[model samples]
Every structure is written in C-alpha cells, then in structure tokens.
Target chain A: MAKEPEQEFVTMTPQQKKARRSRSLALALALAAFVIVMYFVTFVKMDPSILNRAM
Target chain B: MAFVDKSALGDADFRLSEATAADFVALLKPRVMSLVVFTAFVGLAVAPAGMNPFLALVSIVAIAVGAGASGALNMWYDADIDAVMTRTASRPVPAGRVTPREALAFGLVLSGLSVMTLGLVANWLAAAMLAFTIFFYAVVYTMWLKRSTPQNIVIGGAAGAFPPMIGWTAVTGSIGLESVVLFLIIFLWTPPHFWALALFKSGDYERAGVPMMPNVAGDASTRRQIFVYSLLLAASGVLPWALGHASAFYGVGAALLGIGFVHYAWRVLAQDPADAGMKPAKALFGYSLLYLFAIFTFVLVDHLAMRMIG
Candidate 1:
C-alpha cells in the first residue's frame, strides 16, 4: 500500500547538531563513570572462574 | 464506543488498517529475526555445559528483544530511505503506524531491558555480549557501514553472527574456541546469502542510494564475490566436525547443505543477468535461509544426541 510521500530526510540545524553532539559526549562520559563505579561495587569482588566450570 | 458509532469512514478505512498491520509487522523484519533467533537458540542449546533452564529461557528472550530493538532502531533511522525503496516503503515508521520518535524510544527501552535483565538472570558475560550485539547492530551496522561501502553487509553480518557466541557465553560465562567457530560460520555465510538478493534487487538499492554490493561493485563482480564467499561458507560449516564441536551427523548434514549453497551460487554466477529467468537468484535467496537454519539445527540436535548416548 501507499505510505509516506517524498519528504526528504530532516537535516538538523547546526546549533541543534552541536548541542546534540555535546550532549551525547557528556552522556557517554557519564555512562563510563557509572560503569567504573559499578565495576568496583559489584564486579570487582566477584571471581571470574565461577564461569570456567560452566565452560 | 463513540468512535465506532461515528463510522463515517469507508471500506477503504478497513483496508488501511490491514495494510498498516502488515507494515508494522514488516518493521520487525521476521526473515532476519528468524535467522538470528534460530542460530542464537542453537548456540544456547548446544553449549558445552548445560545452562539452568530458567536462565536459558531468559537468555533467548533477551537476545530476541535485543534483535527486535535493533530492528526498531534501524527503522527509525532509515525511515527516509525506507520511504524510497519499494521493498521497504511500507515499514512501520515509513507507513506512519509508528513514528520515528516512538520507534526510537521502543528500541532504546528494549535494548536496556534486554541487556540488564540478561545480565541479572544469566552471566554478566552473556549480558555484556547482548549489550554489544545491540550496539553492533544499531550503531555499528545501521549507523555506519550501511551507508559507507559495498562491503556493508559483509562487516555488518558480524552483528548478526554473534548470537551463537552470546549463547555460548550465557552458558559458560566465557568465550571459547567452539563459540568462535559458530561465529565464523555465519560471518562467512552472510555475504553470499545477501549478495544473491542484491544481485536481483540491484535496482531497488540503487534507487534508494544504498551502497549494497551490486550497487557498488557492479553485477559481474558481485556475483563472482558471491561464489567465492559461498566456497568459504562451505569450508567453515564443516569446522564443527573437524574441531570436534559436533558429531558425524552435523558434519555430513552441513557438508550437504554447503554443497547446495555452492550449486545455487554457481547458477547465479553463470546465468545471464540480462535474461528473463530470475529463478536462479530467487532459489539462492530461499535456500540460503534454509541452509543456515539446517546447519545450526543439526549442530544442536547432534550435540543433544551425543549427550544422551554418552
């Protein structure tokens, strides 16, 4: 069946693009920090070899 | 109740509903999901050591959700080109049954839920693999390679191939040589299987501005590459037998399927693309799906049988 007609892909304005890029970078850094914290809090103390037996 | 009472719309309204349903289903990409889920399940079922049944169930559900999440995100980003391609024009976002924003949100939620739940229910390693699989499919494949080169599917196929390895990790909580073999089979199989479809649908992709193999490499070169990959696929499918990951049943079964694959590829290579006969290309497309499913199913069943006999 027929659907969306020929609208072009929406191009973001430069300001929006810049803001998005910055926000994404900040979020990625934040996520990395969270991972680091979680690693020590949860993963660091766990023995990895618990898995070797399953293997 | 008030909405139904109004009933001002014509029969065309009902027709549109059916069409919209079809389009939304298409957004899930059942054919692609089938291959992904089947291989992933086989990987889980055939792991060296048994997984807790509940954990295995969770692993499969997570993997499937991750796959569907990737599919949804793909629809969100590719809505523009999706509107252009006849084959894809009716997908959810393109057809307006779902908005790009809605699709994006659905994808993001599914991705997070699948990864986190998988990690909690199974091993962190499998959860991590699930996370990587989502990233690989959504960001690496849909965002990057898809627009860049003729080799897009070649590299992007790795995202699809990870299911077995993820399954292995879910059970074992670690990677091993066996899971790697499972990965290699799908990696080698992807190009030829996809290029066969591209061989015939070159016009569809070319019009959409997607740089698929046929669009970039030209038809003759693409067909030759398909033949080459087909040979490599045949070689890899037999590795489980050679490496002792499986028994004689899988070895013989995979070899037979691989030979069928090569035969169809040879037809595509030798056929006059200018001719009216599209049978060879179509056959290759259909057989490729069966080939992958059969090989993995064989591996799973063989492993189970051996366990029982032993």
Candidate 2:
C-alpha cells in the first residue's frame, strides 16, 4: 500500500496563542526583574571597605 | 509558518484549561502565607537590631515566597489525599486547576528564587533558615510524617514556627532568646490548634487516610492532648513578657489571650465525644487563629511603640 501525506495541524486557536504569548512574556519579564533585584541587593550588601579598596 | 507534528498538535488540542493567575495564587496557600508573613514581619520588627526598610521588605517577601513554595510542593505531593479530603479537595493541584508537574516546577523555581534572593539581601543564616523551613515542610512533613504518623502536625509545626526566627536572623544575623520564644509560642500552640480541627474533621482525615491525632488515639485522648498543649502554649505565650523582651502591656494582653485559649481548650476537653455540634472544638479552632494573630499584632505594636518612644 502507498503511504498517505500527513495533514497540517493547528495546535492552538488565535486567542489561546495570544494568551500563551502574554504568559511567556510576563514570565520572562518577571525573571528579568528578579535577576536585576538580586544584583542590586548584592551590590548593596558589598563591603564598603572593599569598594574603597577597589577605588 | 512553523511545522508542527500531528501527534504534538493532538496533544495540545486535548490540553486541559490553562491555569490562571488565581490558580497559581491558590497553589501558594495564601492564607498560610499571610500568617507566615505576619509572623516573620513581627520577628523582623521586634529584633533588637534594626534593618534597612527596603532590605527588610525584601527579606519578608522572600520568606513569604519560600513559604508559598513549600505550600505548592505540599499540594503537589498531597494531591492524592487532598482529592479525597473535603477540606483540601478544592486546592489547585487536587481540583485539576493545576497539574502536579506544573506545581512541582513552580515550587522548585520559587524556592530557589526566594532562597537566593534572601541570601543576597540578608545574611546567609536567614536564607539557610528559609531553605530549611521549605524542605522541612515539603519533604519531612508532607512526604514523610503526614502519612506515617498521627503526630504529623506536632513535628510539622516547626516549619511554620521558623519564619520569625528567620526574620530575626535577617536582622541580627543570629538566633536569640527572643526568636526562640517566638518559635516556642507557635510550636506549642500547633497541637492544640490543629487537634481542635481534627476533633471536628476526624471523618475527613479518616476518609483521606491521614493519621490525625483524633483518628489514631480516639477523640478523648486527642482532646486531652489539646488541653495539655494549650497549657504549654499559654505558658510560652507569656514568656516573652516575663523575659523582658516585651512590655508589660504585651505581657498582660498575651496572658489574657493565653487564658482565653486555655479556657477554650478546657471546653473542648469537657465536651462529650458523641456531641454532634462539636461546638467547643469548633470554637477553639476559630479562637486559636485569632489568638495567634492577636499575639503577633501585640508584638508588632509594642515594638513600634518602643521604637517611637525611645
């Protein structure tokens, strides 16, 4: 028997796709914010003496 | 357009409803998180050494997130039992609003984020305490003690009690007698508070196969244990004032609340096991919530007053 060609598939409706995109964007933004906050906190916690010495 | 495998498309098409923000919040056990936050805040507020306002805020938020992560992990692990128990049947994981895998991943990620952020903002000691608290609740209590023994809440209570200690550590970078007092207050209070609920919800625990005190030891024994723990809790509640860590005002208020707690526990002890109303047990359970909140509120208020005056 001859093989049949597979049909194209649509995984998500437009609304669902939009929602997924928004969620992904929000998650990425949150991760970025967390990273920035941690960096700031680490900077704040650094020893003043160390900073003076570096300078 | 991107090429999509038909099998993958089929799987996606059959997907369950996407979890909403509300579902994620539900997984965090917000009520429990709120209590944890309040206690931790009180710990931070009352510590002898003050923290920068911004750093203190960060530490509290991290502790809250860590507490929430533990809650999510607990829900993920207990989904099976939660589904069978009426009290927890509607939780995100068990209610099918969130998948177990999703909850687990969310919990692990938040746990890491909270601990690392806290370590950056505060000392490692505070971060270590938060990490241990999460692990204790999720692994020790949820996975081990909850199913194996009736004394699960007794030991699991330590996880809840650690927040204030962590808060104190964030300030002083060390544990102190005051933090220990706060820990003791919550630790001693847990048995009575939870056992009161167990008295009324024995059937739920039984149906879920949870070895709750009331189920394993009988109602009378559980009630007696509640009374004993209540006395201990009441004593511990007054210790902060007696130790001179808090003012006489806090001492008097805590003493009054402690007496009220013991009185309620006594009522629970006096009630007949067959009494359908279970009013005393129910009343004690409700008041225990109020008692903890009032005690912590007093701690915060007293600290604020002292800070303002002195």
Cα lDDT, model 2, residue A13? 60
**TM-score on 0 to 1 scale for chain A of candidate 2:** 0.68
What is the lDDT, from 0 to 100, of the residue B156 in candidate 2? 98
lDDT of 2 at B194: 94
What digit string (tens of lDDT, one per residue) describes model 2 on residues B125-226?
999999999999999999999999999999999999999999999999999999999999999989998999988899999999999998999999998999
DockQ for each numbered candidate? 0.02, 0.25
DockQ of model 1 vs. true complex: 0.02
- Model 1, stretches more than 4 Å misplaced? A1-55, B1-26
Off by over 4 Å in 2: A1-9, A13-22, A25-29, A32-36, A39-43, A46-55, B1-17
Residues B129-195 of candidate 1 have per-residue lDDT tens digits of 8888889888998899898888889999999999999988888889998889999999998998888
Worst 10 residues of 2 chain A by lDDT: A4-13
Q: TM-scores, in order shown?
A: 0.78, 0.90
**What C-alpha lDDT, on a 0 to 100 scale, does residue A3 get in candidate 1?**
55
Question: Model-by-model lDDT, in order?
Answer: 0.80, 0.90
